[model samples]
Target: MATTEQGNGLAPRGTKEKLTGDRKRSDPEMNGGVPGEKPVDKYGFTGGAQQHCGESAEEIPIEVLRQREAKWLEMLNSWDKWMAKKHKKMKERCQKGVPPSLRGRAWLYLTGGKVRREQNQGKFQELDNQPGDPKWVDIIERDLHRQFPFHEMFAARGGHGQQDLLRVLKAYTLHRPEEGYCQAQAPIAAVLLMHMPAEDAFWVLVQICEKYLPGYYSAGLEAIQLDGEILYALLRRVSPVAHRHLKKHKLEPILYMTEWFMCAFSRTLPWASVLRVWDMFLCEGVKIIFRVGLVLLKSMLGSQEKLKACQGLYETMELLRAIRPQYMEEAFLVEEIIELMVSEKDIEKEHHAQLRHWKETHGDLHCKSPPRVHGAKAIMAAEPPSRQDLRQRPTFIVESPLAPQTDRVRAEASKENGKSKAEQQKTIKPPQETANPYFPPGDPSPFLNHMTVKASKESLSSAEHDTYL
Candidate 1:
């Protein structure tokens, strides 16, 4: 319940006030007036892309902005060297905040999304040409305007921004057919679209879904539920009083945290803070999310005001939903979040413990069948076994049928073309066993080689970890 106001370490008090005043003076009307529409006195609620209200108002010297942009461009041009030799410096820059002018490209670089975009050139258009799943299409259309309703880019229903948003979400549905159109993903995809082109946004979304947060938006939401448990465990350590109060009110983490984590704080945090969180999140991992949740809980309920105002679950939920704008200011909030001492090792330890608890209480959590890829043969030799099979065979080895078939076809083709079978066989080796589809490549967990009841086994590899699940 410490109530002392701490200044954002990023700027001095006078500088913070100057920045605020500059934004207020540079109202949206001064900056092209929302494209074919009159600017309102205020742009609805103060969150999402409109967090700065009048971002164009700040009159930083063009030369200064160029200097910042140049620094970013140089880092991006030599990203491999920077990542290998100056990762700590890169993280420090991200923590300070990626300049808004260069944020899109910086984000693409940080996520390695530019590489994905290159590999999947023309793929988004291909997916767009095919009619999307009607069910997912309907949901995506309904939710399109619900995201950043006041931002100029998506203000009009069929505007370029909205259309781009539709393509990105639709392409994702086609890309990961199994986890089609989770409601939470729409805002995430929308945020990415705001920064980059539709195709690049699609690839960024792919990295987030497949690499950052695998299994989170899946049908069962098993990852989200497990993380809820993990969040509660961290709360007990970081803010015991808040934890006790929540327990007394029978408040479950899911009731409040589902949207927060699932959407990667796109809804809960102010736009600037959201961007800052994303910057750190791309460089670091899920630990930033856990630290943020703990900070939010402590700030909301750890004061005398809360003892009177948040007396029940309903009031507490409202407090979280309607957190004051000042508290969410990126400079202060992100500074506080990073200052917290939580580490990846701590999060991993808690994850293993939570997984064990979940298994002991709920038995084996069944995984749904892997979603089928359109117009392609099954990637694996066999479907993942049922719950009974999982219990019987914990190793869950997956052999690639496509590889062996391709090798045989190559051998026959070579023989017909006058080359000997021995030459073909020498060139083409037999397919080897690979990890299960559920366990994607580049997973960093030690237990990935085996599929067992150990809580850690259920989690995705460290490289793919996301706060949503």
Candidate 2:
């Protein structure tokens, strides 16, 4: 399979021959006769004196072929190692932050998502499966449409958002039944679909819920609760004042913060920040999340000074999503903010140690669970709360125990007549004093449980709240 150009270049290495359009190889010196030299043909491949293929051409030398083969083998060997090194470097670069143009492809590579695969091709082509359970297809279909209602483009591309979402969710429901499709998967899948094809989106979703953000989307949401509890601890350590403010105001982290743990900063932050977080998230593992939560809480401390200027959980989560410090800078900025706001938030250091421990132990157990077959179903029975587990519930250092002691139902009845001042009065109450104090004051209280909060100007109003539910 030697090409003509390579053959020409390899032959007659010592002689200078310029090739003409017809693949003729000629040497000018061969044409000219020197004083003692025998006259030769102009072409480098001369058979007889002064003849260029006049009758029979001379046989090519075996040594020439051997030399050419040696050179080719050498080049192949070098190229193989070069490609290997290149691939390794590219993997490193992807984990840092995929360059803009290569992001889509690199994301596929980094997360092990195959855009076109034989097994999944038919699945992608087929229409979503209709199942008997109001359990599986019904729930998947509902979220498929609901995932990105805010995006007009998604709405327009019925195939892109609604259809793809349904396909992936349904297929996954069939693919991994133990941990059936969950609520957070919709938004996470929506974000991936924005940057990737549907198939890649499906696998990326797999890596996320199953590998990356484990336990959170599981049967009990125990992992999600654990992460939030960890976040609260970090916030308290790094931004004690903000933690105090949020609690003094009777704010529960999950009510506002669940989106952060669920989507990993997707809806809360700017797109760029979300990607940066994802970069570290996938590389550094789940521990990066706690550090990030600490970093975000610290950032908000600076904004807390203005009267009634406090932010809700969603806005706070969004701010974390908005800021995208470079890899080198994120560590310092996180530390600086934590130090600035907390004076004592050692959560990052503790997390760093925990990460070291995690690395030393069996690799992230979160991602290595046995795959199950419960599409859109809980993976396992809920773990019952035991005495040992109950004893470990987080205790506030200066504050009362974690979990509020009273339900807001009694407070709501008392405030029905005094709806206007109920929230302000609630904030002033000694019992509620044990709760967070900067709580917003308004009618139709936003706080629904004992962990009640007042509606902020930016939060959902009564009409909007009704619509949202």
Candidate 3:
């Protein structure tokens, strides 16, 4: 939304021009013409890494890292004390309102569950060093880089956030190998590291995944599924029109709210609103997530009209991401949501009867089958291509009970072809070849596979690549 000019170097376009005076100079370095020299225009500023005027590179202070660590440690310890006071004051302030800066820390403090007065200064190391089987460590290692692979905000910003996430995730995998590493946890961890220290983020996540949220990252995925069922039921009760439309279309509420509920609205809502929701979440429990889900459906009541004109679940998610309470009457809208969706009876019920009924009727909602590892497995299970089926084409890999049969057929063909070629070339010397036959003619040799080829290295022209295996 804000344009920064090239002058400021950090800002986009017109924004920088307004904020900073216009100064121009011609320099080839700015255009990446120079190989090793620091990029400079007439002002002697580099286009990439920043350097102050006439300042030399210098060593960073050892105390700085210590200070950073110490600060979080102190905050972690004081969290309980803060929350004890915070719990007493929260209800009154919610009726009033939390100050902005105070809100983020308050949310962090409560969510951290930093209750015990005793210091956990050395306990983090003790927890980290606890002996465990090395298998999860291997899994964590594989996913470490792939975790936050995208996101320009995470890219080249600083190693601090990434390093923090890696340490916490690795420690957690070591701590609870049962959950191991799930795809969704990395993005959640990245979001936490944006606001708090790595250790605090780590512990907070552990609490949420274990105590607060129901088996979210567990093998069964029971808790997240339960939450989805509850959300759907609440929506059905609160907004029957939306529910009927969604049911007719076979759309699941979890498709939109999965990220929302799992991350405590961390990824979907603005940081400020997330903080407010979290303030209540920690003081209360996971009830707030359900309440918010009801709110989202109710808010979109206008949009969900006229034969499901509402864009699918993904479009609903985009709408949530783009707008916030500030645009509307924040207090009244929040109150309306709470009044319509949340009930003491629903929140108080340990496990709702409606949820049980939904699960029983729609067993597929709870399904968290392990992903097919081999492409071949997927191909064999492919549905017969119908009007609906053809719209979603099957994978290229061969998947079938007859896959072994297909392999045997290929092997027989290879043998027959090899024998014919050998007999035909018998007049000359037969080429010394084997009948392995995985690779076809003109395939690059193993050694040449490492060599760079522009054609091969370039991304596929189409949306996807066909896999033979």
lDDT of 2 by residue, 1-469 (tens): 1112222111111112221112332342222212234333322211222123233222335455444333322322232232234544432432444433233333443343432232254664453454523476766664454444434224333444566667777767766667666666767776666555566667667756665565566554445544455567667656678777666655555544555667666655534445556654543345555655666565554345721444564454344333443322433533443234321124445434544554566354443343321111111111222222112111121123444434554475576656667666766533221221112343332222222222211112221111101
Worst 10 residues of 2 by lDDT: 373-382
RMSD, one per candidate, in order: 17.2, 35.2, 25.6
Candidate 1: pairs in clash: 1-302
Q: Per TM-score, what order, best first?
A: 1, 3, 2
TM-score of each: 0.67, 0.46, 0.51
Residues 1-469 of candidate 3: C-alpha lDDT, one tens digit per residue: 0122222211221121211113232343222232244544221223322222333122225455344333433333343343345444444443233332233233344443232101244554665666444665554444344322232223332344455666777777766655665545765676555444455567667656655564666654455656676677767777787677566656665455665675566545533345456555654566666777677666665244533544565554445444444332335434653465465467535246644665677654443433211111112123111222112121222223433445555685577676766675664443232221223565422322222222121111111111011
What ranges in model 3 sit over 4 Å off?
1-88, 92-105, 116-121, 129-153, 302-308, 311-341, 348-350, 358-469
Candidate 2 TM-score over all chains jointly: 0.46
lDDT of each: 0.61, 0.44, 0.45
Residue-wise C-alpha lDDT for candidate 1, range 305-324, written one tens digit per residue: 56588888788867876677
Best by TM-score: 1
How many backbone clashes are present in model 2?
21
